[model samples]
Target: MKTTFEFLNQLTKNNNREWFQSNRAKYEDSYNEMILFADQLIEEMNKHDVIETSVGKKSLFRIYRDVRFSKDKAPYKTHWAGTLRRAGANRRGGYYFKISNEESFAMGGFFGPNAQDLLHFRNQIALDADPLRNVIESNDFKNDFGELLGEKLKTAPKGFDKTHPDIDLLRHKQYIIRHDFTLKQVHDPNFPEIMSEAFRKMRPFLDCMTEMITTDLNGIPLV
Candidate 1:
């Protein structure tokens, strides 16, 4: 991981294709390191949670940059990232981690849920927000993610009441729980376990939201 971090730090300075091509060996080394790290992360995740993501290098996202649409056309990514999905239809939410010199974090939750899912979440909050509140307001949740995050509308979201008690939770378009890591933290010897523990803390919120989204307004299972 340290070697990977050093490689990414240099990548920030030399983002051009020419430099990347010239240093392909370094890139490969860093990539392999990330793959090994991701494999270990999956092992750690499965100890406390059911992970559907494949083991080994398959868990790691490609380092190549897609320059077709973006204005910044750097040929390589400056960080190594992996995403893990919880196993089974009943299990909802995702796990993500990125290692970089600039920003590194272990994040989980509903990133961009569909309209139907959003409606269901809001309905649950409107009907009874105690369960959701209990999860987010828990000491472990507060210590880990600080608070529920992601984009929100300033005003009421369509039919929801502006003065509703749980309007703050309903206004969210995305429910994201994140724990950012400092460079020192990323470079720690036990970073894989450390990051996995951060992800484990999201279970309460994930379980709460999964129940909300998987059930109808009548409190029956949808799947």
Candidate 2:
């Protein structure tokens, strides 16, 4: 990780096509190391969670940036990131990691849910917020995630009562929980175990969300 971090840190100071092309060999070495680490990370991850995406190499995001829509057009990204999908139709969340000089973090949950799925979440909360609330408000969840975090609307979403007791939950446009790690932690020898355990802490929230998003308000399986 020191090598990986050094490469990325240097890239930040020299963020141009010429510099990346000149350092291609170094970049490949760092990239391969990241892949190896990710592979180990996934193996440990499957111990406590079911991951549909098995190979770490395939899970990694491309280092190249999509510059067409962006104003700042750096040819390559300054970080390494990957995402892991939960296995099967019943499992309904993702696990992600972003490694960079700025900060490193791991996260798990649903993001950008479709309208129907969002409605399902709101309906479940409106029906009885306890089950969902119980998970997020628990000691384990708080100790790791602090609190539920995601994009939310200031006002209640359409067709939902603004004054409802659970309106806070209803206004969510996305649902996720995250754990940040220091650069030292990211570079730790036991990082694979540490990273995997951080994700393991997310099961209570993820399981509750899987139930909410994959079922009708009456608890009928949607899929």
**Model 1 quality (TM-score):** 0.94
Candidate 1 per-residue C-alpha lDDT over 145-201 given as tens digits, one digit per residue, 9 for 90 to 100: 899999999989999999998989989999999999887777787878988888888
TM-score of 2: 0.96
List candidate 2 segments past 4 Å from native.
none
Itemize residue pairs with steric clashes in candidate 1.
none
**lDDT score, candidate 1, position 59:** 74
When summed lDDT is taken over every stretch of 10 residues in candidate 1, the lowest stretch is 182-191
Cα lDDT tens digits, model 2, 1-223, are 9889999989999999898899998899999999999999989988887888879898899999999999998888999999998888988899999999998999988878888878878888999899989998888888889988999999989998899999989999889999999877888999989999899888888989988888787888888
Distance from true location, Cα of 30 in model 2, Å: 1.0
Instruction: Give all candidates' CA lDDT scores.
Output: 0.89, 0.90
Error of 1 at 85 (Å): 0.9
RMSD of each: 1.5, 1.2
Against the true structure, whose lDDT is highest?
2
